[model samples]
Each structure stands twice: as structure tokens, then as C-alpha cells.
Target: MRLTNNLLFFFILILSLYSQPVQAQSCQELETWTRLVEHEFPSVESKSVRSGSLIYNSIRFNLLSDKYFIPVFGKPFEKVGKLKKFSIKVKLTKCKKKPKFPVSKRLDWYMWGVFSQERAYNDAVKEVVLLRQLRNELPSILTKINSPMVTNDDLEDFAKIVETKFQRLLPSEINKLEKAIEKQYTIASKNQLTLAINSLKKEEASFDKLMIISKFKTDNELLLKKLDQDTRHNFFKKLAYLKTKTISELVELEEMLLPNISAVTFQDYAAINTIIDRFTTNWYPYSNLPRVEKLRNYYFELKTLLIAVNHREVIQQIINTNTLQGFKNTQEAIFKYTFSSDQIILDIKSAIVLKYRQLQLLLRIASDEVQSKSYSMATRKKLLNSVKQIQKYERVSIEGKNLINRALHKSQVLCNYIMLEELKKITEPFLSIEKKTIGDLNRLKVKIIDFKNKYKTCDGEVYDGCIKAMEGIEKNYK
Candidate 1:
């Protein structure tokens, strides 16, 4: 009976412990604690992020799927240095009707968390700040570098920054950035070119300036080619204007040198030719410009003047030759030149005629000497040879041929006279023989016959005198 009573008492005590009330959990409490889980996205730092379940206060709590702990682990309390903890309360509740399962126990429980929702929000704020910085800084860099002094390298550096530093931006934003950079670069480059051109304009127009212009042209070939037609013309016009000024000065120098061309030294002649060559080669491309056209006119005029001067020199040389052959050659050479001034040709022809007249006078004086029997046989023969040389000259005018022929005939007559006089002298020695020997008479007759035969074509007075003298010798010998 004592054992039965003790078992009943123990059973009564167990029943009381089993019947204790358990508190029910609320959805609001679950939500408030669940909010502590972080929404961590994938990244380089996220890859190295510590993972797995949490062990806090010696209790193992598995992380829900797709959730992660923050990198710094748990958040701390706002005012205190203690780690922040979130707790959810579970309370027991009776069903309004029948329960699905009998309550086995009763208790009020708590679940704790140390979590936050600020990390994702903070990352978003940083992104917005970075976007603003890129948008503002790129244009700022471009604005700072848009001066006339900016180099291509500076523009290129900005381009490199756009490519490298803005990789995190959206593709659309990156494209806009690239376009902005390109536009700014163009403006900057144009400013630089304009400034350089203005500086060039202030310089004196000289060969040195031309060389610098040529170098500038070569260096900025692409930029210059891309200019609009009017702008291009204006650009080259300034260069052409400078060149025109230089060419005008050169033309003045050439005018100053023109008077000396007749006696120009070899060095001076070469310099003139060099200047002429540059007139053709070193001019700018704005040919339609009025100043350039004026320069071209000056070049042509100078060329014409030089040609006329050279023609005059040639004509003077021909006159100085003092020979009909030289005059004939001058005529032929003149045919090859396209005379810019007809007066030049007319002057040369007139000078040649005057020279011919002078030569004719000289020949007439020699003829007078021959007709008067003033020169020896050798001198007469020399005059005849000179006349014959003139006759043989190629391409003489008909008048010149007639004059040469007349001179030749007069010279021949003179030579014939000298020959006849010498023959008369030879006969005189034989004519002086006192008495007539058969041999002397035979010699005188033979001489007369031979002289008559040799003088068959001769009709001049000297030939008649020679025949009469031989007849006298023949009569004396008889």
C-alpha cells in the first residue's frame, strides 16, 4: 500500500508539469527579426565573404537560403558598444475549435539576431555619387584642356581617361562621354591651328617664312584638308598673300637687275635664274586670288623682259661678229624664238641692216682701192677671198646675195688687174731686147697667144692694157 501511494503522488506531480501553457509565435515578430538578414550581391569582395551558419551564445542557427551575413558580421547597438541583438517572442495560443495536435508542452521562447539592411542601401548611394562624379569630371577635364595651347597629347590623355576610368559606367553613358571628348578635341585642335596661323601672319614674308609654312602644312595636312572650301581658300589666301608680298619684292629686285643683264656676271645670272624658278615652283595654291594673280602677272612680265634682254644680247653678239655669215645665222636663230615684243625683232633687223651697210661701205672702200690699182696682188687676192666667203654664207636674203655678188665681181676684176700688171712686167724684160732673134720673136708670140687665151673671159680695162703691151712686145721682136 505505501509503494502504490508513492507512485500515484509522482504521477500527479508529472501531470501538473506537462499541463504548463506554451505561448504562440506572431508573424510580425518573425518579420521584424527576419529583416536583420542582409541581401548581399556577388562581387570581388562578396566572393571572399565569410559564409555558412551562425554560432551565437552557443546556439547553432542555420542561415536561410540565399541570405548572407554582412562582411563585418553583426551590427552593434546605437549608443552602447555591445553587439546588437534582435529577439522574436513565441507565445502559446488555444485554437477556437478542435486542435490538429495535442499540446505536449507549454513555454514562452525567444529567438535572437544581429543583422542590418543598411549595406545594400549604402552601396546604392555610393553608385549614385560615382555616377555624378564621372558626369561632372569628364567635362571639367575637357573644358580645362580646350585652350589654344593644348597639345594633341593632352586630348589623347583625356581620351585614355574616358576609356579607362569610366568602365564602370553604362555603355550608353560611356558612348556619350566618348563623343564629348571627340568634339572638345576638335575645337581644341582648331584653336591651336588658328593661333599658330595668326602667329605666322605676323612674321615677315621671306623664304624662311615659306619654309615654316611648308612645314606647318605638312604637319597639319589632315586638318587643313578637312576645312570647308571657303575656309580653305581663306587659309591658303593668307599664305598666298604672304607669298605675293615676297614675290612682289623679288620682282622689284629683278627690275633693278634688268639693266645689268647685258653685262651680268655668271653668279648674277644664276641668281636671276634661281629667282625665276622659284616664281614657278614656290607659289601657293590659291591661284584664283587677286593678289596671287597679280603676282603671276608680274612673273610673266619679268620673264618676258628677261627674254627680250637675252634676245638683245644675242643680236648684239651677231652685230659684233662683223660678218654676213653671223647675220644670216642670227636670222635663223630668231625664227626659233617667240618674241613677246615685235619691236625687239624689228630693232634687231634694223641693227643687222645697219651693220650690213657698214660692211658694204668697207667693201666699197676696198673696191675703190682695187679699181685705182692701189693694192698689191696679194692684198687684192685677200679682198677677193673675203667677198667669196660672204657669198658662200648660207640663208642670206636676196638683197644680201646681190650685194655680195657685186662685191665679188669687183674684187675679181681687181685681182685680174693685178695679174695683168704682173704679166706686163714679165713681158717688159723680153720687149727690151734690142734686135729680134728668132727665139725672142717666137717667145713673144707664144706669150701673146697664151695671154690672149687666158684672158678670153676678161673684159676689164686691165685685160685690154695687157693685150696691147704684149702686141707692142711682139712688134718690137719682129
Candidate 2:
């Protein structure tokens, strides 16, 4: 009789804990804020509002604002102009429920959102600063680099090669070269007396290289004169025409000898200096600038894609892990308040776990879209193969697996999003490809629906259905 009484007491205690109700959001502050916003921004329209199980109450608003400005004149002549402003109105209904979540938890979410936005904006500013610095440094560096001294005959031949090979380079390339040369000359002229000795040295080194390569050493001065007469436009045109092999060979020679050449060894200095000079005059103006810029842009694009991919992966991981942990934490905390059965806690835990798995799958799909955008076909194929090798680790319950399928389906849609943006960049005039991409995305949506339906049919609320779906979807990627 005593043992039975003890068991009955324990059972009732558990029931009492499990039966407690969850606290709801406090409506007062939210209602006040909504009213204030509506009053201040009268033109904004609030379409929907919802408070989640968590602390945040999200309100969607469409806002329209009008700008008013006055033109001012320094002198007596200018007339002021008036502009009309239009605004759209949105309103949020006041919430009645009092939020149960702690103020600290609510504050954390708000702060995180603001911090994330600020960090992204700061990073963008840094990139722009770096780009500007690189642009500014380019011209002076080019001038410091010396060009190879070539004979009149060689110049004529090189010019002909440029005309034939680099026909695609526009006249603007020559204009840029002229501007660089003029800038260098202007700077040198400002400090002419101080620069005279260094200029002589440079000229002598250039002349010596010409002498070494020239078949007619006696006509050195004449060759130098003729070369100087050649316009920067014509010089760059010739440079653009040089074969890739010639440029590579020149760069190789300069790299090997540049370190050993000192002012004392005039011949070696001249030889290496000439190659460096050629690289600046020919390579910089024609090939190096364009190629480097193109590669940099490509790298920037790749980095951006990676950032988006990484963000999705990180957020998904956090959401999945944190949500699962949150569920566990909630159950433990609420055990004192709710006297529900162990079965109820177990069911909630299982639901939370399944939700996490679903979220993980969704994130994986989003990541895949970024990979597809940045990676080559062969690389993507290899990556997919690697994923297949790890399939066993990813397998989960039927519902979990179904969630994975849905995630993978969503990933296909994400791919379309990335591809659409990529195509816009590649296609000069935007092609009518949006429809095709949209169709592909729609198919993914249909697949997600199917996955959800199939997931619902699993026998147990938290069975092997999720795992099976995950495995099936993994196979598709492979």
C-alpha cells in the first residue's frame, strides 16, 4: 500500500509539471510602437503582422516618402524650384497578447540584426577604399618601370606586329598611355633641376641597352631620336600587338636578372632595367592591366558568391542546432510549470529535432546554389561525388529525410536565383532568360510540396521517414 501510494504521488507530480501553459507576448509595448509608427509615417502601409513563439513580433510595411529640397544660388541670378512629394500609408494593428519571453532575450535578437547590417556596410566601405588605393598607385609604379631599348628597325617590326595582333584594343588604350606619359612628364618638370641627374642616368641606361641590341651602333642617337618621336598612342598600339610568348620571355629574363643589377654594373642594370621598362610600357598599357583587372573582378565575384554561400550555411547551422537546443532548454525550464506527461515532452523534442533536420537540408540547398555559381562543372561534379561518399552520415528518419528532400528542392530554386544574377552579368543586354530561370525555380517549389506531402504520411510522428527522404535527395545530388 505504501509503494503504490509513492508511485501515484510521483505520477501526479509529473502530470502537473507537463500541463503548464506557455507564456504569451505582452501586447502593450508592441501596440504603442505600432501606433507611434503609424502616426509619424502616415503614408506607410502595414500588410501583415505576426508574433512568433519567440520574442520578435514582425510587421511588414510598405512605405512611401516624399523629398523636398530648395536650390540655392551664390550669385543673384538663379530661381528656386518646387517639387511635389507623394507618400504611401501603412498601419499595424495593435497586439493584445502579453509576451512571456524575457526582455534580455528579446533585446539580443534586436541587437544582432542591427550589428549584422552595420558589419556588412562597413566591409563594403573597406573594399571600395582598397580599390581606390590600388587605382591611384598604378600610374607612378608604371613610370618607375623602365622600357627596353629597341633599334628603329625593331620598333617598325614591333609596331607592325601590334597593328596585326592587337586589333581589338580600342583607341582609348592609347589615350590612357598618353595621359600616363603626360602625368610623368608634368611631375618631372616640376622638379626638373633635382631630377636632371636621375633622368640622365635613365637615358644612358636606355641608350646602352639599345647599343647592345642594335646592329648599327653608330646610328644610336638617331634611333633614340626616332623612338622618342613615336607617340605614346603608337607605342601602346605596338605593345598590344606583341605575342604572349614574347612578353612571358621578357618577364622571365627581368625576374632572373633584376636583383643582381646595381648602379655599378651599368650593362647588367641596363639590360634588366630595359626589360622592366618594357613590362611597364608594353605589358602594363596593354595586357597586364586588362588581365589583372579581369581576374580581380572574377575573384571579387567569386568572393561575393562564397560570402552568400557561407552566410546561408552558417545561419542554417545555427538555426538547426540552436532551435533543437532551445527546445530541450524550454522543455527543462517548463517542466516545473507544466505537469504534462513525459510523452508530450518527448513529442515536442522530436518535433524540434525534425525541424532542425529540415532546416539543415534547406541550408545545404542554399549552399549548393552558391557552389554552382562559382565552381566549374568538373569541380561541382567532384564535390557532388564527395557528398555521395558521405551519404551514410547524413541519413535520418523518414520525415527528416523528407525535410532534406524539401531542402534540396529549395536549393535548386536558390541555384536559379544565383544563375539569374550571373547571367545578367554575362549577358550585356539582359536576355529574356528570366522566364526560363523562373520555370526551373517553380519546379523546385512543386518538388518541395511533394516532399512535404510524402513526409506527412509517415506512420510515427518522428520515425525513419525523414532519414529515408534525406537519403533519396542525397542520391539525386550525387
How much is 431 displaced in model 1, in angstroms?
Answer: 45
Q: What is the C-alpha lDDT profile of model 1 across 49-160, one tens digit per residue?
A: 2322222111112122111112122321222122122121112222212143222111111122222235533443354455556656756765655555666567788778
Error of 1 at 445 (Å): 32
lDDT of each: 0.52, 0.35
What lDDT score is found at residue 101 in candidate 1?
21
Best by TM-score: 1
314: Cα error in model 1, Å: 4.5
Cα misplacement distance, residue 14 of candidate 2 (Å): 99
- Name the best candidate (by lDDT): 1
Query: What TM-score quantifies how close candidate 2 is to the native fold?
Result: 0.13
**Could you tell me the TM-score of candidate 1?**
0.35
RMSD of each: 18.8, 50.6
